[model samples]
Target: MIQEKRSKRGALLGLAASILVLVLVIVLENTLAPTSQLFVVLKKGAVYSLVAVSMNLVNGFTGLFSLGQAGFMLLGAYTYAILTVPVSAKDTVYYLFGGSAVKFSLPDLFGGVDTPTGLILGVLLAIILGGCVAAFFAWLIGLPVLRLKSDYLAIATLGFAEIIRAIFQWQALGPITNGANMITQIPTFNNFNITDESGKVVFRLSAFFPMLIMIICVALIVMLINSSYGRAFKAIREDEIAAEAMGINLAKHKMLSFVISSFFSGVGGALFAMFANNAQAKVYTSTMTYEILLIVVIGGIGSISGSVLSTFLYVACSEWWLRGLDMGSFLGIKLGLFRNGFRMVVFSVVIMIVVLFFRQGIMGNKEITDLLKPRKKTKEVAK
Candidate 1:
């Protein structure tokens, strides 16, 4: 009963905190200019947070070192872009290929593209479709690759990603994939902003939209992590042979983790496309996977909150906070050594320092709520 009370209190505290954060985001969006640097950081951070957490689900929780996140994301992005692009813009977007093979757009089919309800339903459907596509591919790939252990699994998945990228860019598939070209004109987060008839902005929700999605997705992942299946995953991660000995289905849990991770990664990819206002196969490269891997590691492998915190920090440092380092001047100090790609160099060094010193990472498989708990003070009586 006491433990249950503590859990209930924690739940209430967490809910209160989440509501406060959402309120804060709404207030900031309305109070500040739409172009504020904070918005950029928040929007991108939210998207990356989802992907990072998805990757963490497999790598940290299930002990699967799959490196095909970019491939799944590419699938998701293309699925979303191909399905959401306005039919009128099809000729232009796929002009090089003569026209998109797909005739209908999701938004158009729902209730016409202009209706608010239709737009919401259409985008939601498209995102889910993207995830389903990714999960399907993950299942197909997992059949053989999941049998491999450790680095071999990683190599096979990485190869799969490269192959998928190549396939998506093949000229013969241009009608569907756009063949090395970008798919644009899809509805983006900016569309969520409320505007007057004359196009004057009334409320900005570009950041809030992604934040809301990220929170919901992350919450689902958290609940899964706290479930029986999640425990089975952790058991497999700790000792596969031992897990199997304990009556756990290694193959089943592993496949479930892989598919779920890919599903969310695909959703993240769709969100990424919305954030960028375009989707291109070339952009979802091995480098992207490595960047997300770095986030997972730097955040601590098994911690959901760690991934969220680290993603925001990583994005902000690379995109905004350390940007001056690339301009050859920071804090009024100008130096030739700081020019161009110097920011990344400094960022890389900082990452190394964190890794070497902290080792287990910022949270080390612990969530933010772990810190929220008060420690009991012990009294020492000396004679």
Candidate 2:
């Protein structure tokens, strides 16, 4: 009992430490770090963190191999972008085939409103709408595709993603999507402000705000995974046949996971669209989905904390350190080739090495709690 007690205490300590580290990082990014560089890295990391966590929900926790995250993300992205872009901005050369394609901005019911408030409302609406739409798709597809397993499931999801892309690519949907032509005039998050020439009400997308939101969502997922329902999910992942024999409703749980995962992915997608200030359907391809899968696998299947940590590290290394390198002045040498695809190549190689050496990934099948157990000391009697 003492040993068990120690183990629990150690787990709590580890969780506290991890939270502390995250807090410190956020603080540093806000106060000390370069604004543009820090925002870029954090924004991208937060987006992928959502994708990684959602993929882990289905693939890691539920033991399903899903490859349609990019498809779902694209749907969310387009939905949010379409709903939020200002009416005046839609009249430009960018929005050419404008009939009833754009929704008219409603008059403020509560007195007068400012630009910042309007932008914030738009963002909130986008996220909510994206999540609802994605959930609907999850339910629609879950009925038929959830019946398959392994490679068949992967193929089905891949095809579904392709179908979504093709639909957007179709000219029939041009009124809604602009179809292959890019959607522009997407107001950036930083564009909104009620400054008094003092830059006081800046409302910049602070590193802390986005990170806090991401962490909160991640924590909720972790809590769900550690609960009884989460254990049931693990049981299904380990052996579906045995889990069903034990009276667990397999189909119900599977659908639940899919819906929840897709909803979060949609939220993530909306966040991504807002950060980018533009949403292009062409970017939501199979390659994007595959990259997210790589993140989940390399971090460790069925590991939430692993995904979060890996995402930050991956983004920092890829976007901040490697891609942002001043190649011409690196050690005063003419090593300028390390500024472009070099970062990606190196990132890919690192992933390959991790797979080769640590196939189970950084966290393996264990949670952060499992790594912090206190060593058992051998009790000595009277010698």
Candidate 3:
């Protein structure tokens, strides 16, 4: 009973702390300009974090090493970009075609209200549709690929992602996908900020919107991981033979996880497109999948908090904070090695060092609660 009380208190404290941080972020959003570089990195981190968490769901939790994330993201990005673009802007944006084949925006369902509410609803619906489309693709691909195991599965998924990129780039699909060109004018999260009569800005609709979505998605993953189905997935990950002996339907659980992961990845892709302010087939590349996988591993496979923490770190290194290393001069010295892509080299080395030395990553297969708890949850469960 004492332990249970402590657990309850810990949970309550965690919840209160989470709410406080969220409130602080909102306060900053209203005070800070949406275009602030810090917010830019934060927003970018939110999108990548969402994608990484989705990837972690299948790769980390399910023991699936699938590499089809880029493909699903590409599909989702294209779907959202195409569907959310204004009908009036389509013709101009798609100069290659007379206009976009779809010729409508989901937000126009309200007959183009032009209000903040209308924009929000429209973009949200488009993102949902994009995720559905990506899920559909996953359903098709998972049928055969999920049957494969180990590295073979990775190769197959990677191949399929390339196939998707190629298809999107094909000239025949140019009318809808804009071919090799980037699609622009789709409503973005930044477009959702609210302001007062004095134009002082009242609310940041999307400043916190993407992160909220990511948090909600990550929470659902936590719920699933704590459920009976999640246990079965872990069992399968441990030993397929033993899992089969236990009478768990391996194929069914794998398929379910794959589909769910793909859905969120698609949603993440839509968010990515919005964050980028444009979508292009070339943007969603194999490197992206590798980066996300690297992030999952660095955060510790099956560790959500690790993924979240590593995301900010990864974004800071790749996009902002570590950019100083990539320049021709650093700390008042000019170096030949510190030119252009040198930051990535240093970043890669750091990742290699972590993997070589730390091994279990920043958090292993452990949740943050495991640390907060007086005892390991898994040990308690086993007992």
TM-score of each: 0.95, 0.85, 0.91
The segments of candidate 2 whose C-alpha lies over 4 angstroms from its true place after superposition are: 1-30, 33-36, 105-117, 191-194, 197-203, 324-339, 373-383
The lDDT of each candidate is: 0.88, 0.72, 0.82
How do the residues 1-383 of candidate 1 rate in per-residue lDDT, one tens digit apiece? 97567656655555666666677889999998887788888889998999999999999999999999999999999999999999999999999999999999999898755678768899989998999999999999999999999999999999999999999989899998889999999999998888888888899887888888888888788878878999999999999999999999999999999999999999999999999999999999999999999898899999888898899989988888888899879989998899899998887887888778887898899777666655632121000
Give candidate 3's whole-model lDDT: 0.82
Q: What clash count goes with each model?
A: 0, 0, 0
Candidate 2 backbone clash number:
0
**What's the alpha carbon RMSD for model 3?**
4.2
Candidate 1 matches the true fold with a TM-score of 0.95
lDDT string, candidate 2, 259-289, tens digits: 8888878877776776776778788889988
On residues 1-383, what C-alpha lDDT tens digit does candidate 3 reach at each position?
Answer: 97568656645544555556567668888787666676776778888888888888888888988999999999889999999888889888899877888867888875552676668788888888888999899999999989998899999999999999999999898889998999999888767777676776567866578777776777777668767898888888888889989999999999988888898899999999999999999988899999998888898988877887788788867887777788877778788878888889988998899889988888898766657645433221100
Model 3 clashing residue pairs (backbone)? none
Candidate 1: where is the Cα deviation over 4 Å? 1-7, 374-383
**lDDT over C-alpha atoms for residue 107 of model 2:** 16
Compute the lDDT for candidate 1: 0.88
